[model samples]
Target chain A: MPITRRRLLTAGGGLALAGATAAACGSNTGRGGGGSGGSLSHWYHQYGEPGTEQAVRRYAAAYKKTRISVQWRPGGNFDQQTAAALLSGSGPDVFEVNGPTLDQILGGQVVDLTDLLKDVKDDFQQAVLAPKTHDGRIWGIPQTVDTQLLYYRKSLLDKAGVRPPRTLDELVDAARRLTDRRTKGLFLGNDGGAGVLGATPLHAAGLSPVTADGKVGFDDPAAARTLAKIRKLYEDKALLLGAPADWSDPSAFVQGLTAMQWSGLWALPQITKALGDDVGVLPFPADGPAGKPAVPVGAYAAAVSARSDRKAEAKAYVRWLWVEQTGYQEDFALSYGLHLPARTSLARKADRLRQGPAAEASRFAAEHGHADPLLWTVASKVAYQDALSRIIKDGADPEGQLKAVVRTTEAELARVRKRS
Target chain B: MPPAALRPLTSNTTRRQRNRTLWFWVFVGPFAVGLALFTYVPLGWSVFLSFFDAHNTVTPTDFTGFGNYRRILSDPEFRSSLTTFAVFTAIIVPATFALSLALALAVNRLRWAQAFFRSVFFLPTACSYVVAALVWKMSIFNGVRFGLANTVLGWFGAEPVAWLATTQPPWYWLVIGTVRLWLQTGFYMILFLAGLQRIPVRLYEAAALDGARPGWQTFRHITFPALRATSVAVALLLVINAFQAFDEFFNLLSDARGYPPYARPPLVYLYYTALGQGQDLGLGSAGAVVLALVIAVVTVVQARWSGLGRKEE
Candidate 1:
């Protein structure tokens, strides 16, 4: 028998109603049981190639006693998925939150993790924990920490007859000498926005856009100087216009088209895959006359949904995956060969990371890195992007653009504060 | 004599009429309820929300009366978005209409394997927008040398163009328009083909017998009035889709934050305002309400201009 639209509608409505009723009744089949140790649902962003799925299932099987079911959803537009789930109160119990938006998510409905990780909190990197904490209340546990590093094609550098730059002046001179009309010494597409523009340069210059107090601190003279250097690079044709910071893939460095690419440690695997053993990693050049090289520190956070009824189980699962068994570090190395453990202790203990180039880069990034603290605000992302676009597309003055961004951000912060 | 003069009233006719009316209502009732629940109810809610400062995320707190609408009126971003939206609609609507009509006419002339040809044309409409966008972004319209479009361009001695990365506005618009055409033209073509079939062949034959050429005949009668209704429907649909253009732009462009100069369609901006950055539900809802009104007005204007609702005399 052919189904009519009316019949379909009736069936759908009836099913939805029944589902709602069942949900309200706290159906044990789907819903996690907290203290009784039933099934726990853990959602994570997908990673690795084809073999990664097998590794994840193996990891899940190893931790079967936790009764946790790991559902790895591919990481593309995760915010939309999370938002929809949050509204319907059916979001994953445990999920990933970006470093910058850590506080905002926490403020909304994120479960507090202060008491949950009281004993083990200090064991993790302070930088990782900083963004996840608000008013001394821990809202999330760090899963992985990332930091920006300069990726160079060793063969390209050698072919160009230039050594890696040790100082800012030396770097500029090297870039100038190395650059030709067909190829650039450095490739950055900062036209997309401020985050892309600011991330590498600000870190290299030893400046932070946001301070510990969640205030706008991006208007530093050092930041201006860095922007000036970028402008000079563009003027000299030392940087590729084709690979605008907004749209250019960092993989250009791996593809041997560019001499240097400034990105995070995550690109190591990709670079390794593309260029094989011909890539060399280095920290971005130091800003001051005699400062150490620096990179921007970024962390991925894991948090329990505020709407989740199985908060305890979710927290327990996070502790297990991220803290207890060193599962996160293992997964990071074995699965994607991308991430570094957020916990310093775990990084030291993980044999897989210690034996690879990823470990070396992670350790370098961690010791000398800056993290953006203005992540909790909406204006930061937009303002950052707009500032970059203005600078690249309209040839707007960097100082003026940065100041505008700060002004806009300050106003947004005030508005949000007032609303609260 | 009085009983004979008084004719017996037939109850069967009245009973049959009552049954037909009941059946008609039964069919209409489901749709009426659906319309009330999904359309009118949400629309009413949206209009109500527009009066206050309503956010789309968290719990909407502030209730500044007409604050959102006033802000929207003065906002440069909103003005730019409206302009962008208008340009996008204007380009896509007429281009899609002409292309679909041409395709329909071509397909209608085919005798052998008509169904296969029709299916081939409509295949893109069935593909998910996400899949299509990804494929277009990665493979076909790839900005790099590896892309199919660039490979074809290479044959003509042209360098690979960064379709997504270029600061050039016209190129960006062209790329977006091409994708939209690829996805939407097929569905509209089928609609036009159906309308073409409904056009009486006798009229064309009569026009031909009158010594009128094929193109002239089509221009005079067969093509003009026959496509009027389909054009109106397609125009309205295109306008609605243009305003609601999010999935392709969002997926293909922008980062995790959904920031500007990429996918920041007004709806995307509204979405970001609500969920991405501010978590402000009020501003987003207010933006949505404004967008709805804009779409409604545009669609109504098009429908009126096209004489979509006018009955044949």
Candidate 2:
């Protein structure tokens, strides 16, 4: 009790010890109970569609078994945040990934969810399941399939006397002819088609992202030529450059800023609401002798974390929300945004998708759709995308860029192979 | 026996020193612990992780010594990011220094509404970088005819240009540079204003009496030289800040698709490599360590050149 120096030192040390003990006892991340007990943390990237957050939260609220806390991570950094959180052992117990990456699959960041789909595996679309599987184990449950293709205004094309392009050259010419004092021909993003169309040209040229044996599949010379055609569109300034929104939203097309825009099936409802029957859908047109018209199909899949302490509960939550709940799945795909139901049966039963541009889009997706290879990592994708940007925006030699990308892709493939 | 009186004084002095020491520990101890825990611990852990094969996990048993460093060094993308950083620094540092100094000089010379001008100029400093980048991307520099820049160009019968696109002219540099300048120059201007006010009025009067010209000559002889210390400090800070630039570039160019390869700073690139889908923390940590070294060397070299902490003669 005396104000002695020794007493002060002792008191300080004791306080420090007590503080450390309290801090250690506290939760690392403020959102606790993901590891144990009655609560679970579910994360989804901020979907651009209105009511997406409300809808996901509504679904979470319906689950009576466990208290599900949904963290709607905003912006494009969801993958980064998920990866970091997983590494730190503080990530969501159940989460949504665009698809399971090689890192997530190989490193055991995601648990094998094939057990959830065992009985109903045949009902789900194979294209949606392919990217989520590794070594015959499904790492994720397909929630919604987003098909990226071209959306054009029928009225604008009719006014300009431009038919829906069936070939890459025709698409370019149509884009050129549609440009005038006000409206530009097409919009493929602010980067002049780099973000969305980067891989499209490869698919348009009939090149696979990766070979069946896991080799770099986009190294052919024809791949470069297809990209060069995109550059021609850029050079002509026919492609609508920067709009308020990027190519993801159908804003450019709906606002009549561009006659045609590259967007996903998710934007179909908004586009239909804005333009009605005047809107038309087309696959990115075929290029070269071996080419076929193509649509890039991607899916947002629900994956449970392997490192989650409550793995069984998380899996049950995933299974309950994505598997047993067909109504919620259909609503997630159709009501909030227009995406194809991951279940083939649900897609078949959906009356809305059976008519109009949706039907055309679904047909194109089945006929000409190309899903990215499971072996192709995000690093390879970034490299390939950068090559496309350089080719289209900067007039860099496509052959050279593609060659460089091949090296990067091969290295990534080798790394994955080594790990596996 | 003769020094007995002085012994009590000595004892009192010792007690006062002890009390001061105890108070110092009380004030500084908590902050020192926090600094160690938050900053130094992570820094040390990062260095340790740089030598491991930490792909998706932080704790790793596989020690791949120098492999991550080799990969980062050999990576063309990382090298390209370094080049981008260098170009950004070269553009931003001089432009910011000159503009901020000019603003300070202008505001200092104003006899009326100086406070108003200062506040007006300083307001952008309060705006978040992400918000400003969004405004710049969505409204001002957007390539559409309705965008502010394009609309202005339209009045002159000019075609709308994609200001952020990697076109032949590379107008994105202008957009990035201008936003940073607008955001940062005000803060530095305030620093220069403080430096300006600190100068003795007698020196300027003496310079005027010595037949120095009022505008350029007096500025060169008196004003510029007097503000050397502030100038050095500001330039050093600007250089470091430029190297660490992230939020604006990340917000403006990056999206769900990807970042354009051209303007990616090291930190953004590292964020993607270490934390993005690749989740290769080892390689990312190596890049970070290398970046930190580069920043440290640059800062030291700049301080040496500018004589930043040297005593004025």
Candidate 3:
């Protein structure tokens, strides 16, 4: 308490050193509970929309059986953080993932939820459960169903005297026709549309890239043509290049940067709020001769870590939150941003998906939504991504690229099969 | 009396020596621990991991024995990513060096407002690479009609260009490379300025007296030679820094899950392999080890070429 020079210097130096350490190490005061009082800890990647963190906390607070601590980690490097945490055996008891990869399931990191799924198996949509169900044992319970599709400006198309394209060739032409001094027609995504391009063609062709077996589904000549046809859109300058937002964000479409954009169902409410009746939705139009209009369907699944100390409690929490608690599931799906409930019964009954693009999106997702095969590996995906980028953006031969992809895909499939 | 005095002196000397030894360990301990924990340990573990097929868990299962290294080398994406990084460094290093040197020379000569100008130039260094990337991507070079670059293009009767999205003509390189230049030039400029100030005033006066002109002559005869060591160090740093390029490329040119082939650098490629959907820690660790070796070799080559350790008379 003395105001001496020695005391002042000591205090100041100590405070400065402490501040520097905190800055360098980035305050380890994370939000998740550190097992104080033996509470259950859950982790979620930070959602962009407001009230999501609070909503999760509100759910955790409702559970009086145990104190549940939740950490809403900042997005961007969530995968790295989650993986590192899980690897160290200090990860959350319960967490959510886009879906369990073959690696996660094979690594024995995720616990099987077959017991929870035994009765409620048919209640969930099959497409949503495709990734979660591997080796005939369900690993994760479905959390939210997200599907990607094209959101178009009906008014802009009408003014330009263009109908929504039903085929890849038509899409190319329509994109070119819709182009003017003011607007370019389509935006699949900023990175030469590679985000959607790799999967959409397969989806449109009514084929998954890799089947349950290792057979190549996207090796069709028409699929090759579809890849090549995208070149026309690029060559003609019909595609809008870079926008601030990615495909997940509806900002580009709402702002009228492009007349039509490939976006997700999660953006339905946001797009409707922004553009109202001017918006219309369609699947990634058929790319191959035998294809149908299709969309890429994805979902986040609640998984209990095998390494969790409270594995049983974590499973119970997951079951209660994602399965038994139907009301919370609906709220989680629709109230914040639009995502169809994983439950088929609840999804169809939800009022938001009862009409318009919401209804259409849900219907299409149920009927035609394509999930990337559970066995798909990063190498195989990259092979397709590179092939697609080259064919569309760099004027490479599509058939040749597809063949190259087939070779790589087969190799990767073999590697994973042997390893897993 | 002499014996008493000698013992006291010896004890005092011994205490001073002991204090110095204690201080040395105290100061070096934290840094030594940090280096081993974060850097050396990780590197060693990574080398160990390169031999096996690891997944989500750091603990590897299969003993692949250089399989990851062989596989990655054969993988076209990894090879191309390395090439892309090489090209990126080639373009960025020279542009940054020249611009920084010019700016430094200009700042060093200022009789007044030198601090103001230096601060203005150095302001960009204060901004986060990711934040700067977003600004560049969203506002300045965004494909929209009202973007700053587009607005300028429109004035010149050119169509608004989708800078980051374009891959055919490699226009995206222009956008990404420029942001790298803008974000980095300031820090390097400060270095050059420091180097400039260290140059003896007599050298410049000597050059001036020897009929060395103001523009190039002064720089060629005096400034450039005096800053040779600094230039070599800056160049070496530039290459290493360029190889670690991630934040700008990642933020500016990537989608939800991965970067396009054109935008992929070696580190990003490794990330995709290691952690992206498949979560192959083995391949990623192998890639990282290989990359570290590459960086080490490049640094050594540069240091040797620049005569880094050779004593200059």
Candidate 4:
């Protein structure tokens, strides 16, 4: 009890160290029970407006038989939090996974959902499910399908006397008509670099840089044609080059500075909030010999942690959420408007989404979406984009650039295969 | 009589020696434990991992002796990353030293608000690197029409420059250097300030009495000797930081794949290879070991040249 300097210093230092460690490794589980009361903790990136919390609560209450608690982490940076939690063994029992960060998370023990999905495997769309499988095992259920669509200013399109294009040439004509010195036709101003350039075009061409077997098999004349079109657009001054990258906001398009923009279904709520009546959505124009329009599909998946102490409980929750819960689609629709339902049946039900341009866009993307098969390998897609972007931006020879990328990608694929 | 005298002396010497030994252990024990736990232990683990095909997950690991190192030497991406890191360090180290020294001199001359100026200069160091990078990415150096840099350029009738997007020479170097300078100048400024404060006033006074100008006086008497230790410290810190420049590149320039296009330093590349892209921990470990040796050799050479190991007068 004596206040000696030595004792005080020792106690203070010990307390400080303990506090630091706790802060580093602590879980923000005040809202959810961690396995107690038969509760399973779930974490997801925040979606939609203020009404989203209500929808989440509604879903949780309706599915009370499962005794699962959904705790929403409010931010777009869920990957960082999830990574830290995973490293510390305190990650959510059920969490979301993006395409690029999937391999990193899987390096840790992620649950194999083969048994869980066996009962309801046929209910989900194949396009949605394809990206979530690895080595013949289903790792997650696709929660939402995100496919790129062309957002255009309805008034501008009407004034320019143009309809949404079905082919690359038609798109260029439409773009030229809409473009002026003051206002450009399209904005592909990517801040990160050429990866953004390759995704849409590659998806449209149906040429993924990596195969399911982890081989580079994406060198095609279709890819070359897509690159050539992008370059021509850039050279003709029909495209704006300095807009903010990730310009998913429809306000810019609605404002008429940019006549057209490329974005996914995730931008629907914001677009509706900003420009409610003056927007239209169409699939990305195709350039292949088949002339079938294609849109790039992005998706989020829900996977249970392999390290979860209660795998049965987690699996039960997943089954209830994906299959048995009738209100799941409605919850998603109300929370994040324009989100494409992963289930084919729900997407076919037109009443699920809001009655506006967003609903039409969601329908278009869902029906015509094509995801790049390189979704499993992170490096090859990046390398491909880097190569593609250089060719477009620097006017490098398309064939030579594509060949170089193919070579690098094949080598990288070989390395991955050898190690695995 | 001689035996009796020798007995007391021996007893006294033995007690003193025991006391000194106890003090030495008391002073050194915590550091020894810390070094073992934080530094030596991880280092040993990395070295051991270098000899094996380690995975990030808790799977059964296989021993592939020197395979990772051999692969790293042959890997083109690894080679590119090493070259990038070396270039970054070479440019940043000298620039930071010169700027910090200049700032320190300017602050030393100011008779008012020295603390205020120092704090103002060091404020950037207080921010999280991610926050700083994001701010730089969105507001200051944004590529859009309304971005600060672009707006400024527009006023001069010059076209907007895509500072972050371009892969060309001066633009890429400028962006990297600006970010590096923003974070590092403050650290080196503090170091230089401390060194400047330690110089004796008598030397400056003597120079002034001899009709030496302030600039020449500083150069000949105070600045040269004062900066010896500070230069060594800054060089070593810069080398370590350059090798570990992950947060800036990772946050600002990174693609969705977690590899930056133009600015992938060796550490960022290692991270992308290990956990982000390939998930090849074996090659990543090899890259890491190579980076560590590079830093170690650089620091040792810097210390030797700067006389950092010499005893002070």
Candidate 5:
């Protein structure tokens, strides 16, 4: 008999031994189905909200014809565990990826969902489409989009007599103005985003981290200028180093820890609840002569397992859930949490997203949002972050840092080619 | 009489020996099964996987002998991680031993409520490593001005320090190091306490009668030599635990997104390579195999130095 996901999970192997307690705690392993023609398995990372799990199970249950087993894995180890399952030949038939990576595509682990997506393909925002497309084939169906931008306190900026920053220079000036013994201005992350926004600044400089053609594209001198600017901000005491929490939670912003914070759209509701009409959002300030304001848009997309024997069935389920059923998709996005549905028409219908800063953020995400290339490996990503750390924090030469990053990225691209 | 002669001397011995063999396996069965399944099997698989180029991580179809090992051996990050772990081990082992030994000595001489003091110290040992690390990361050593460490420092006319973020001054090491020391020292103290109790009261009496002092001289001559086996065992345990450090580093040193490479030990580095954004299992396994080898060599040297396996009279 072929090894099924259940046998591999329940048999107490390595994953079972390691993550079994986490699995037993929140996972819905008993979702009433196996791989019959209408049966499929799906997996999701843990969402902290109370009802998110039930919402997913309810969505899966609506398709009475198909028996879909949903596994809500705990967050930290989800990616690793999913990779292990996929490699073990016992992966979920249909699953979600944060974004399409080159390894998934080259491993042939994900199927091209484009053929079935023709009907509703155009309705997806540009932010959702660019990252999922590799070699002109759409690897995943964008479920909902997540965008990170600057959330500023209007009261604090007004008190400092500073207008909302529109450029990198303006941001630095505003940050210094807002800085005092009481509060700092901006909080990117705990590590000053040494790893997080290393490539994002490149995006703001009208540069992408790397090209899909296997060339280093973020080596521009403008990126160096951006790094230098960040260092100046650091020297001015315009940044918060450590907070009680990371940037993902709205607590830092809500608790008045900083004048402004860089965070995702998911935290919008909590921030709004704490300080009504006091909060405003802006895309990361553009840099360089060629630069434009931008938001880095990432999404969890639904894709079929290429190795699944029921690839056709899995593809149909993916289409039915993410594309065909707009109501469930809308509910999946808006009802559970503050997320923009992948479909443009659906996002337009979200009342909370239709007005004020929400509308502006939505528009900015669609227009200025950038996607990571499929071929960029995790090692290259870490290298980019390290390069930024060396340049901005350690005062190392920017050109040298870029060259080191370039060398590693080229090796990663070569590795992809060899694997493919 | 002819049948008895034909049966020979082997018949009874064979039956008895077979029964004893069967009983031996029966008694040791669960332990053997658990060891094979959890420990040895994964080890064998990791060694096997080190020879293959695996993408999915589980199924290794491509046989590239020694390629994975060669890749990890040359990687600068892997080498840096080893050096970091070496420093971490050096600090933790002696520190843990000294703290535990001191606590054990004090508790051994206690005239009343000895159990209370012992229980209080050992409470943290019973706490989970992840939970303890998180408590330290969030409550005590958090980078805010109001955090426990910073609050105390502020009273001294010093500005609040970013205890976890000051990488240049290496303040983060104190955060990670102190939490580990607090969590583990108590358990080792218990071991030392057991060893302390085993020393004969008559020996101390005799040393005193011979004009030996009640403090340093007596401890050096009597207590120290008497706990040799326990000290060796404790040191070995400390070395192994230090090398395998993961839970504390991961929980304390990482942000919500992921860990920075500033203070990762070998296990955490291998985890990222294998399971973190890049699922390069072959390379990760190779790194693991190499780490296991390092740990094994260190353990063997330590054991030999301590005379761990030698027969004691």
Candidate 6:
């Protein structure tokens, strides 16, 4: 039909009304929808796995005590978004955190979940709880555990006649020998070795980023020596400088862009699907006799906002979903992406994780896994990463850079100490 | 006091005046309130936050006067960001100005299909900077061998280059510069086209009558002199925009790992300072205030140099 002005205006108004109604309904998710216990809002960073969003939504739907709406945030900057949201007081009533931040602990942003997990606290590992605990109070319940280690191709290493690296020096030499026109020897990340290797070398050197006294521990000569070795690897052009995908994903390794890649255990499913029996796993190599190999533990946890009006309901949901609901937890961890269940009992029972590369990765994690110290604030990490970038990418003096980063870390630690 | 008929007319006039005044406020009231609420209020809040140690929270009780400013000013990373902004502006402003003027001049000389060419050239202006930057990063300048740039390089028997690597060779500048130029030049060209249309045809005819050539001499004398105001305005815009460059820089450079230290503009640095993992809003706000002041001073200096508001003499 030929449109007239009145008809057009009427249609536009109708569409606007519909849009307004839909938006009102969407925003009302946080409020009760005939539920007696009220409603809660929960946020999760968009997981890369296919079925994670549907799974979380399903779990939220299953909770009978309170109605919950899931807001799946997509982007690499979920932390920044969450920080802004919490500061504005419009944040989710329940949310996911990789580890409880210092501000979250000291500023009273996160509710203490210690009492919620009191009965089953023993099921969770101490290493997993260390980052979430502040002053002996657990701020979050562990949702899933991820471990980062090196993934190499068995076939490629055999062809090159290079065994798995057992030390930092040997790792660098292997990277050089394995590099060719077709592929690079190693992939630490697109930013040379700045990001994925930031804490790895420190762990390999038997050093913590922040010491028990809240002082910088990475400025020691051992840390500097390890970083310099990585720099030499970078200068040899044996490490992958830039790839379409970063080290977090196994795309660089599976696609033959790099022979060996530093990645997480979550990528194992995809790597095995692509490379079949050709893949192998190893922890980051040791730097010297004083040092031991280490696999860094990365995890996600669930927490309730202290300012949430539905704190009781939110805590109930966290307890129900993350703590009590083992079946859902196992599915959430294993179904979409391959990850270790937060509970040691669940991990021990999983048949898929009992053999092959998965078994080896779990063994390494159990033996040599390291998590960031309580005092390792984001400021210190940023400073250390910046220095690492300069050293590896720009060939800056590692000793001088580490010294400067120590000053920055010390200042950050002082702030944390003052706040606490 | 004068007459009965005159008094009624006076009342009618008063009523009309009242109606107009009511309508005036009705038109402008929401806009005024919106400006105050969204722009001015936040600006004032930012300045206030800069004076306090507002980390992770907007409402901070701890006041530290000039400490945030001093910290940001002393920061070498912040200082280098300023230099990055300077380098970006120095390259982009001139490059955009010349390219847009050239496009406008070429489009003006077209006898047929002028509208088609104009629309075609101006289409990219409608694209979002974030989307454009992504296309440039992922498809064109990606480091993989199958990327568009590398594919073309491979045709010429050259090794694939990591275009975004900030180590030794700064090919990232080329990638960033080209994307901005493509996105911005079309809009400026439209502005220049408007200026070109307003230029009196009689002047060109007069120059021709005075035995002037049609190509370079005519353009150098007549066209260049006439576009002074347009050039100044476009240059002013380009300079301000160059300072506010964030979307492309942030999206193109920032990865899951975090932003690289190199090629960080002032806005990106301030964004990281205020909002990134550290959550130092006070220092970020201070950096923001400093950046705004710098932009203002530069705009004023350029406006004065170009004699923007002075009567043409």
Q: Interface RMSD values for the candidates, listed in order?
A: 4.2, 1.2, 1.9, 3.9, 2.0, 1.4
Measured on C-alpha atoms, candidate 6 has an lDDT of 0.87
Instruction: Quote the positional error of residue A348 for candidate 6 in Å.
Output: 1.5
Model 3: CA > 4 A from native: A1-36, B1-9, B201-214
Worst 10 residues of 3 chain B by lDDT: B1-10
Query: Which model is ahead, 3 or 5, in terms of DockQ?
Result: 3
Q: What digit string (tens of lDDT, one per residue) describes model 5 on residues A1-420? A: 998874564464545445855865656433233346445788888886568899999889887667787878885666666666676455788888776577877777788888977877789976668779877889989888888889999999999899999999999999999977658888887777675575778888888877756677876788788877877776676777778878877788888878999988888888888899999999999998989897888788887777677888778778888888999988888876577788889987789888877888888888888877676678898777766765655667877877788889888888877776
- Pairs clashing within candidate 5: none
Question: TM-scores of all models?
Answer: 0.82, 0.94, 0.93, 0.85, 0.91, 0.94
Clashes of each: 14, 0, 0, 1, 0, 0
Candidate 3 displacement at residue A248 in angstroms: 1.8
A304-379 per-residue lDDT for model 2 (tens digits): 8877888888899999999999999999999887889999999999988899999999889888877887988888
Fnat for model 1 comes to 0.22
Fill in the DockQ of model 4. Answer: 0.33
- In model 2, state the lDDT of residue B21: 93
Worst 10 residues of 1 chain A by lDDT: A240-249
lDDT score of residue B308 within candidate 6: 91
In terms of lDDT, the poorest run of 10 residues in model 3 chain A is A27-36
Model 5 earns a TM-score of: 0.91
Please provide TM-scores computed only on chain A for all of the candidate models, following their numbering: 0.80, 0.92, 0.91, 0.83, 0.88, 0.92
RMSD of each: 5.4, 3.8, 3.5, 4.4, 6.0, 3.4
Candidate 2 ranges with C-alpha deviation above 4 Å: A1-36, B1-15
For model 3, residues A241-299, the per-residue Cα lDDT tens digits are 77777777888788888899888787878888998899888887886657888777878
CAPRI class assigned to model 4: acceptable
Tell me which residue pairs clash in candidate 3.
none
- Candidate 6, residues B1-313, lDDT tens digits: the string is 6885666566788898898887676556656877998999989999999999888878888899999999999999999999999999999999999999999999999999999999988999999999999999888988878889999999998977888875588888998999999999999999999999999999999999999999999989999889988998999899988988999998788877678888999889888889986788899999999988998898889889899989878
- The DockQ score of candidate 5 comes to 0.52
Report RMSD for candidate 1. Answer: 5.4
Off by over 4 Å in 6: A1-37, B1-9
